[model samples]
Target chain A: MMEQSKEPLLEVRDLRVDFRVPGGYATAIRGVDLTVGRGEVVGLVGESGSGKSISMMALLRLLPAAARVSGIARFDGVDLLSLSPRELSHIRGGRIGMIFQDPLTAFNPVLTIGAQIVEALQLHDRNLSGKAAWTRAVELLAEVAIPEPGRRVHQYPHEFSGGMRQRAMIAMAISNRPQLLIADEPTTALDVTVQAQILELLQRLREELNIGMIMITHDLGVVAGIADRVMVMYSGRVIERGQVDDVFYASRHPYTRGLLAALPKLDGAREALVGIAGTPPSLINRPAGCAFRPRCSHAEAVCATAEPPLLRAGQLESACYVSDRLSGMTP
Target chain B: MLRYIFRRLIAVPLLLLGVATVAFFLSQTTRGDPLSAVVPERQMNNPEIVAAAKERWGLDKTLAERYVIYVSNLARGDLGTSFTTRRPVSADLAERLPATFELVLAAMTFATVVGVGLGVLSARYQNGPIDHFSRIFALLGSSLPVFWSGLILLYLLTVQLGWFPGPGRLSAHTPPPPPITGLYTLDSLLTGNIPVFLESLHRLMLPAIVLGWSVVGVITRLVRSSLLEVLGQDYIRTARAKGALEGRVMIHHALRNALIPTLTIIGFAFAYLITGAVLTEAVFSWPGIGSYAVSAARALDYPAIIGVTLLGSLAFLLANLATDIAYGLVNPKVKLQ
Candidate 1:
């Protein structure tokens, strides 16, 4: 089943990013180890300020000037963190594609969608120009299923509807045909029908292009529907990692269990949504033991005193003291 | 677009009417008669001569009748006659306008180029020494008086160093260029008189710097704040994420959006330069509308005073129209209402 010999497209180990604040530094991403093999979708789930986006942004070194990032992130056997800005830029849009949320603001209002896509393609490959770039842009727009690609390509961002804008952003992202795609909340701003369509488009692209993707979202339902593997984050740490079926059916972490329980059940009688009480801990002064101890209902003396490692329990791994008891909870 | 322009142009006459009525009433309502400066103090007792003088100047008519005559004459392009010089007000204004236009253009170009450069530098190096320098420079520009700066520039650059001629349009030795464009530089260039053009440009530099400094301050501060805000936007981040160079992100993504808000300031800045040119002209002895107004004000010349005010009002109206057009051009999202 596993493609054992081929290296993963992108592998990140012990990646840490610290943001210098007014006093000290706030560790936004702490020791996040993730690997995306070719043709696999890894859904990273976390609430707000959970470092889901930070970890992904760090892979490309896209944080602001004040951020201090550390650790090794290797892509195709090359160290990403050590690459010069010029070389890293080559790898950014050339080898990896990125799509962001809020496509309205993500697009430059002054330029046409086709122009932006052409710019993306040109930035990666300097030789293509004029008719060639224009044709490639039209092809990208058509790939995203936008109608009348030739006519619509000339319109500015304001002329596009929200769903159309997101589609255009997707076209821009996939313009270079990179091996890996990092989609950060790609469907958050979309309506239900549009969200489904975008998700379907993503699935179709993943299969046809055989591109590894890291989908960052807070929606567990989205993770369930499309993600091949799931990695749950809390504060600045990834607390659990497993196959989608393993994590969905036999969740081993209390935090993951809390997230799964909070979802509104569609199959049975509608029950009150179970929200995990307590807000996420501030990363500046992270909780001593486990970052989720304050919110975890199964917290014990060990859970409050010492942090647990993400050790393998057969087919899955979770950072918790009482993983055995939390593993068998029915959704 | 045509409708939008027509909507803006339609207000011009209404605004002119309001300005003229207010200017006439204000002159009448002031403490002394405008004719007092012209007539001798010893002739105050001669009621017959005074009534005759009033009739000649149309001052003997009722306020309503005088206003109607003023509007009708204005419509016909007659700006009346000056009380002191006994010349057509329109001719004098026409003679002086080119000087003011030349000064305003030079000052605007210098201020915008240098000030926007400083704003961009400060924003790029935010919280650094460049930012601090730009902030302090803006503070001095906005606060320092124009006449005071004009004198300081004169003392340092002209009087001390003896590098530039002190004030006026040209040296007494250089003959006036043929009046092709009215502006000395253009007229000199058109007439192929390089010496006159150089002298006119030389004399203009000091006052232009004096008038431009404050506007530079305003532009720098405006560009800095707006650029900083734009740099933080998600589009800028997206630009960087797309593997664009840092320079491309700043120029293509950030600066274009930041320029929209700055355009409004530029319109008002041009109007302010025209008004400030008055004080600057009075100090520098430049032969412009401003100096003409000052000399008229001293002599209580009602026609010249009214003419100057009308010119300024029109300049401002035109500037506002230009700003609206530029606003549309720079920002495609702004569909004129």
Candidate 2:
């Protein structure tokens, strides 16, 4: 799996998203590049306003009226952005399934879970009968490990608990057996126990279904176990990327280092977590140089004037010049 | 659900009592003494005759005493006699209410079909030519006065072009079709009286359009905004992400949810069309209860005014209840709450 897999299943290049706000255009996604090989798991890690979700949404052309997305998102050699909505409809839930955050509000309250699943199944395949769709929906629910799939499918979204609702959403997303499954903050709304369960369910589904996935989350702990590769994003740009273990053990960017330092360490002697000082820069009025320079502890004279592009360090990619300088410093 | 409805039902009588009390007091406060409306001005100066007329009609009683008498009569299902007509207000209401309902129902149909269609279209093509047209159209429709529209339409279409009859529920020659539903159009259709149905529709057209025009604006704007908002919901995006056809996404997902607020607007709009079409009815001379209420108001017929208001309040309440049930039906979360 670590071999340089050529011709990835999904490839995103130089994706940029801008929204028309009151004063002027606010750039949400500056420039992002991502690729997912067949049956591979790529975790996209970022803060709330880091454009992780927006960039993924732009892949399927799912942004709203006010948003303007410009990019090349190629799924199976087809450019998604070039396709019309009518043409894109074939690939949206058919080839690329998306599971959203907040499972409680994701599913339509009025529609039965079975109905929603069946509708998704039948949308792409007109030949599928209602009965067949219903049966398949139950099977999908069972595949997601939802209990009493037969009876529970008939109930509305509110009838299910948070974890069950998220599982039901997974069932709906995977009902069509999409080649690329994009789960956006899938377990963010659940309790710790339920979050683990949901993550396990997602992992199990990935193995059984063998579908390529792009997992978006802010929690580094979530990415540690599941992700094959991790992409660290800051101010709408990919700051660093590499194998998950390599990036986690040898973080290159200052922002990634700050993020890792802030997380509570559970192993060995406990150390005080180093808090990252500044908040994420506003997209409307981002600083000219490196977006994280204000918060970077080792920021020098050169860090403020010119932005540094992603550069190869030892194992992971680095977007800051001070990576070697930080590594040499004594604790 | 039954308990909920039963609780709402219990409030009905209490509400009716409040309405009746308000109507009674309002009639007393208004100008045009009932005696003066009934008797000629030449006979008004004669104090002896005025005293006799007051005694006969019980206008000599205090407001509280009159109210007690009105309530007692209402308990027995008797609406006291009209000051001008010398007939029970109940009989007049029964005769007049059907016309208002017919006109209002027709207007509601027109409003709903036009409004919902325009709304969905506007939302689908947001900021397009159709959206611009609908925005301007709704603005004009809502801003234009009902009586003004009614009069202009009546004058232009009826008096000038002669496309429809000027006024009245039916022509002078045609008697109302056999009273099956009390609605002439429905009764005519049921009885297979095409001529009567056509005539009734012809007379109803101008007034219905005028009354419904403003309501159409309300429903259209409500639906447009509601649909735009609902289309932006997570569920709607999910539906689209499911590769569902745009039409299915718009109607099945967005429209049904959007129609929740529009449904409430439609129900109250229907009630308002019936009860508040006083000027439209007058302008077109369509003899619905709206006209009856106006005449009652003009003639200072206290019992008649109170009866009309009481009936309007009842219809409005029922419409509101129906709307709530519909809201629950469209979105299950509401019923659960």
Candidate 3:
């Protein structure tokens, strides 16, 4: 396990979000606690509607008005949720940047690529002139490895290819030199080869700028190489968390083990791939205790009676009642 | 872009011709003698007078022959003389065209400015008091008939409170300014006649508001719904994430996309206003093409009816062309070619 000897750049504690639905409130994120040191990459892995993205969005207060978010997100010694909207706006793009899943939809169709980048730059820096911002935008585009930045900067979003648009999205995100970045499934919509390039670009940027990043994705392979720590979420709750290497090789939670087993191996004897048995429980009226009990192969009678709190065993923290017994077994 | 515009312009005459042909045949279907409009009721029994009047107006020709002659005359830019007015239909329409254009322009401007403003406000504060009030206002505007609303407003504002002019484009004694654009307000401004300009605007207020009320409802609903949809777009989230203030996020990112669909509705609304001004014009006694068309219809003046139909079709065709060009300009994905 990596030692946390230094002050964390971002520390989130007991983050919760509930959405107002037709009849009653649906708790999307029950309670999520995480910390990211400077220059560290944290991977949040979960299925769709698992509240992985919602937790990050809640930190930035980016969710719709229907969502009721309550959380303590401390960034650079400031409590983010307590700040006024005007004060929060400065921290949003100035200190903490975010890039979404779909770059094509993330960009305004009418505005040029350069204009969007310039907007981010100028929003944080009041004295920056338009011409200087444009020049800086082109430089940022080039920094993201986009070719012919001079000509491409003036073109509209629809004129660019999907990969190029994602590159531009990255360019805009990092334009302000934010200290922390939240990338929500950034490469999910990209091609396989393009995905590698984007991941590489993100790693290089994080290294050069020493910015802490939270990489959210559903694919286990996506986080295997990039993240320093891996957090596995199921049914809106974090089921397991540990150093990336330990979690991959010695995961304790049944859900995490199932996810790792579901990954297709490049070199192995041919065999049928295994998938988790059941779908996630509905949020409105979740099962009495463990939300994943129905899908868990190692579920016990105690799991249905009372929810298990996250218990630490050396380097890993797991929320399963049978995690201790399962730790002794092998694949 | 130029090529697209040129192609659209080329179709204008063909569309006008189609409207003209339909109007001609439809007028023929109405049970009426063309010569009765010109010859007096007493003179209708006199065979010599009726024959001479029929021959003079070419009503004596067979239907097919007259159609051929009508088409040829239309090709030469000649709308047949109106049997009721004893004047060329083109000349009469030319004189009234300016009045209708002025009124429609004023109403459209009013509707667009106020409607879009209300829509933006309503969307910005969804479920708020402002949103509720604007929605109720829109509902009433769309549901209430224009003539009834015009009369009510006229009585309340003009008769009860005496806050605005009753009706007409100007007071009874005011001589119209020199006809530069034939729009009283513009002409008065051009001639540096501020009093005349204010007087023309004063008289223009109530009728324009009454005419534009229904359109305002449509525009508000369209813009409100469109803006609400755009607010949920990914780009809007990106803008907000970029530290843009709520105002800047709305105006810079959301409004542009929201207004694209609204522009199409506005185009059709403008065209509708031109033709739909008939009832509004009657209430106000405004000397515009709509009232001219009404009078022509009553007299069964086929030539005048065809002329007005051509004008209405032209307005629709031009509005559609303008909308297409606007779409190309605002959305980069739209290829003009």
Candidate 4:
């Protein structure tokens, strides 16, 4: 399912973000390199505070003013970071769209769903008339499978249920036919059944539009179902990344293996789940060595000396020095 | 929405009745006889004159009978007779209400516009020079007594600079315009008397500003804090993510939400200003209801006092109703039904 030969839609290199704090600057995204090809869905999986969302937000310059971002984010041959605010705004919700985790909060409560969608449409296309935008907004809602698009269009966000609001949010996001869509935990706030439906809707939309997507979530199940490639982050850095099948089945990093081990199996007899010991390290004052060293059972003396770089092998990349020696062991 | 308004309207009379009962009893408890103001001093010893005066004003009846009579008269739209003015309280109020309305409306409009504008600017430029200046302005406006500010402004603008006309709604040389709405500015405008209109507006400036200053202070702080909170909302971020420029984001998304709370404050402030601009009215000699209320209190005019209190309560109730209706209109989540 991996499409390495396809031209990349978004290429980000050495993306770093530091937020101003009371004492000093805290490193949020230490260094992240990401690539999403056209018509592909790349899963960015990590625990909370792992910089999964911050890295994507930084590319769009959507972070708070206190955050200092330094990176090269090129989307469709345009260096996003270098673009002026005027130029960058054209790209935001125009060439690139974003969906937040909580749709209820993401939407303006006072504005009707249709008006919000029309706003997004008119922001990119100045010539779009209010009537035309309203018509298009209705069509977009119907396209997202919202019931009675005409009536739902006039309804407010609070009137919509969690699942329906997410659908409307997606409708607004894709109102301008964006080339790339960044869904930040789109289904995390939804119910299990609704999550499946939203995932299906996203998959269908991605295929029909041939849009590049970055799916940010902590749910492994979501990534396994829809993602072509996967990147696992820990403490503001990507520890492992590869094709979804390769990374899931033959996971190399100790943290990745621990994550796989933690997943509950439906086929096997009931058993207590194996959780990774200790929490992710704090980004403010991280230990000098590997962030996952204290939690890793296979930690060695060298692991305490320096953090290992991404050691790529074939279709997989893992930031672990002893992964080669542990290849034969099952998670 | 109509049903909601109707329901609110239904409660108005009952609420007014409560206000009337409270005002009537409170005024009745005061240590003064209504006849004292109505009859001459020598008549205090004259039994015939005293009895005639008590009988004419219905003061000869028992307290219960008097209350029943007062309530029955209130039901018939008579506010009884004022001891000081010797005219029906209702007639006195009718003549004075418009003047107070014009003054309070002008003050409220000024307060809302300037207060909300300054608030938005201050919040947009948080921690900047404008923010600091507005913060101090609000602090000073709230802390300074209206009478002190009114006097100071009167001395500076009228006595020192002679930039504006000294008191009253119109100049001493100008005759009153035809009383259409009983508001000089509006009445003059209706009659196409530009000079009277301009003169009335000029005379109105200092009093309105002094009366509105404290309300402006309240509304500014409310809007500033509210907008600051709204600016941090997820929907505001969503608005920005949609490529909305800063101006659009602030006005379209942030301001509307911020103004919801501010709207409630503004409505109550307007109600308060109507009867509370006593010092401003006295200083400027605008001949509004605030001064009427003060003189009524000084003479212990029960009918006039109760009538003013009833008007104040009615304003408060109506303001509350308006705020609720506005809330329902602005926030769809609030079910008007």
Q: Which is the leading candidate under DockQ?
A: 3
Q: Output the better candidate (1/4) by DockQ.
A: 4
- lDDT at position A306, candidate 4: 93
Comparing 1 with 4 on TM-score, the higher-scoring candidate is 4
lDDT value for candidate 1?
0.87
Top candidate by TM-score = 3
Evaluate model 3: give its TM-score: 0.97
Please tell me how candidate 2 rates in CAPRI terms: medium
Please write out the lDDT profile of model 2 over residues B1-337, one tens digit for every residue: 7787888888998899899988788778876667887777999998998899888889899988988998999888898999878899999998888888988898898889989999999989989999999888888778999877777878888889999896888878999998988998899999999999999888888788877788888898899999989887899889988898789999888888788888889999888777798888888777788888888877888888888888989999999988888887888778622
lDDT of each residue in A108-173, candidate 3, tens digit only: 998999999999999999999999999999999999999999999999999998889999998899
**Candidate structures ordered by DockQ, highest first:** 3, 4, 1, 2
Local accuracy by lDDT, each model: 0.87, 0.87, 0.91, 0.90
Model 4: residue A90 alpha-carbon error in angstroms = 0.9
Candidate 4 residue runs with Cα over 4 Å from true position: A1-7, B33-35, B42-48
DockQ of 2: 0.70
Worst 10-residue stretch by lDDT in candidate 4 chain A?
Answer: A1-10
Minimal lDDT window, size 10, model 2 chain A: A322-331
lDDT of 3 at B319: 95
> Which lDDT tens digits does candidate 4 get at residues B4-47?
89999999989988889888887788888777788989779999
Candidate 3 segments exceeding 4 Å error: A1-5
Top lDDT model:
3
Model 4 lDDT tens row, A228-288: 9999999999999999998888888889888888888889779988788898888888987
Residue B166, model 3: Cα distance from true site in angstroms:
3.5
